[model samples]
Target: MNYTLDFGPVVAGLPDLLRGCAGTLFLAVVGMAIALVIGVVGVVLRESPVRPLRWAVIAFVELIRNTPFLVQIYFVFFALPLIGIRLAPTPTAIIALGLNGGAYAIEIIRGGVQSIHKGQVEAGFALGLHKRDVFRFVVLRPALRAVYPSLTGQFVMLTLTTSIASAIAAYELTSVAKLIENESFRSFEVYGTITVLYFLMSWLMMRAFGLVSRRYFSYPVR
Candidate 1:
């Protein structure tokens, strides 16, 4: 016995898959933006003098980092509604992705912040810069430069994890593949094509990250 492959259905569903790809990219972009904000705020709070705030950030980071992301999304999609905090599927998926990525980002950014020399911060303040300015220029910028590679890698993982958003009927790449497989019963072809598309997307994302690093993080040569 032998198996034969058919790609006719996959070819026909290219448009749906493309739309799904767009949705996936949208989620990743918005989710990463939210994650960056959360990470920055969390790191700042972790260093804050306020004991409750520091403990809150610690609890958030530990909870999300320790739990399964799928369960997190389910909670966002299903549980939140019961408490009068309803959200559409797309927003729910984005929030879930952001929170999940943000937890790991907090740790990554904290490591970068800690790696900065204390003298640089002191020097910034001695230059008449305000505390906020000092944190922004001397600490945050350099810290980001130090940890950007790791941060981008984490973003890549988040992008791939968008596939799980399909569980909530979020119209993304994996959802499209599932629909195509259901309609055409061409599991091998549909998934095979999606695998290629995902690879290309990941490669493009890495290239974009490279450009961002070169433009923003490059150190001046003497």
Candidate 2:
């Protein structure tokens, strides 16, 4: 069978495509923001003076990290309605991404924090620095710097995972591509172009984040 690839349908949909991109970006940005906040909370709880709280944090991390994101999203989107909670598709996608990403990042950040030398903490104390100042100045910055690259990489991965949002009717880039493909009946060309766009966007975001890392975190160029 000879297949003729037509760009007309996809090309004509560029305006709507851009709008879909914006929706994806919005969800991703919100999700990442929530994730970062949760990550910090996770770290704090894990290090808590309260033993039960610490264990709870560990359990939360393990559960979220080990499970498939699709299952989690379905629980929120479909099952939650039974419990009288129904999130809009965009909100659900953003929340799920944030919660999932944060769970993974907690370990990464925790590893970075724990990797800091014990001697450094003692030295800060010997210098008469308050606990807050010591943690903020001595430990936190170094830990974040250590895991900067991993965090950036995760965000890039999240770009592709936004397709899951499409499954829940979030109307992200991939979802839009699906819509276009269905209407235009050009799965090969539509998907081929979508793949190209995904790669391009991921690479560009990675490069941009790399620059930000170098500028803000002082991560060594290697």
Candidate 3:
């Protein structure tokens, strides 16, 4: 068996790839912001004096994290119409990814929060600071800082997961690759190009996150 791979169509579709990348980045940013907010809310609820609220948040996180993201996305895109609710592809994609990512972030953030020493909070209370101020000035900053690397790693993973958006015709990078493959009949070459692009994009994200950690975290080098 012999196969000839043509790279021309993939090269010609560079503009489409750029557009998809922009959309992918936009979705990732929006989704990560949503995920962060959800994580914080979940953490606060988990720590609430109200026991029932904490358990409810825990159950929500467990349900989302244990389920498949594809099913979640399909439900968001398809099930809503039956209830007379509509969401544009972008929001649906963002919400699905955000909710899924947020579930995982809850655990990650909880671990960071748990790692904090009691002295930090005790000291804040010792100074007569309010509960909100103690968490804001002490717990929040340290916890987020401790988990910064994991957060960025999760964001990169979500960026890759954005490829699933193509399934619902969201026109992401994989969708562009599909178009090129259909036109040129070169699945190997087209998909190979996609692999390289994904690698480059993820590598860039890793570097950027590393830089951010260096600037914001500044842990002892020793």
Candidate 4:
């Protein structure tokens, strides 16, 4: 069994795949930003006095977490069009990724918020900080610092989930790899290269998050 391996096609398609990787990164970054916003707002609302708001957030989290992400993206891309709410594939992918990641983020952020002691909240008031400022600075910031690792892990999962965007013909790394495989008829070579690209991108993303955490969450020791 002498099967000669050829990487010429894979090398030729590297530029296209790299461009797709850029698309994947953009989607992930935008999605994560949206997720963070949703997570923070959900946590705030969940802790509010309004029962309806808390229930709404809980429903959203449960709905996303309980369903398949592929189904969610398909609904966003296809079903929305029937309701006269059509979005382009890329935006659809971003929205789906955001909503999916945000659900998990809500839970992660909630854990962090719950970790804050009542004494700390009282201390913020004692320092004459406005309630809003206290929530933002004392509660939110420290809570985020506590949950940064988990949050970044969720973001990485969102990045990987962008692969599902290929189902909607969204421009991303996996979509590009599929096209290359079809054209080159070298499925092994194309997918092998794509696998490496994904691993490298994930590693880089984690490293970037680590740097950001160190810069923003570093605390002075007594």
Winning candidate number (lDDT):
1
lDDT of 1 at 201: 96
Clash list (residue pairs), candidate 4? none
Query: Could you give candidate 2's per-residue lDDT for residues 1-222 as a string of tens digits?
Result: 987778998788878777777777787778888888888789988999999999998998999988999998888899989999989988889889999989988888898899999999999999999999888888988998998898878877877788888888887888898899889998887788778877777887888998888788984669
Per-residue lDDT of candidate 3, residues 1-222 (tens digit): 988777888889888888888888888888989999998888989989999999999998988978888889999999998999888888899999999889888888888999889998999999999999998878988999999989889989999999998878776788888888888898888898889888988999899889988887877778
Per-model lDDT: 0.95, 0.86, 0.88, 0.94
Give each model a TM-score: 0.98, 0.94, 0.95, 0.97
Give me the runs in candidate 1 sitting further than 4 Å from their true place: none
How large is the C-alpha RMSD of every model relative to the true structure? Answer: 0.7, 2.0, 1.5, 1.0
What value does the lDDT take at residue 68 in candidate 4? Answer: 99
Q: Number of clashes in model 3?
A: 0
Alpha carbon lDDT of residue 78, candidate 2?
96
lDDT of 3: 0.88
Model 2 CA deviation exceeding 4 Å by range: 219-222
Q: Check candidate 2 and list the clashing pairs.
A: none
lDDT of 4 by residue, 117-156 (tens): 9899999999999999999998999999999999999999
Runs in model 4 lying further than 4 Å from the true structure? none
Candidate 1: RMSD to truth? 0.7
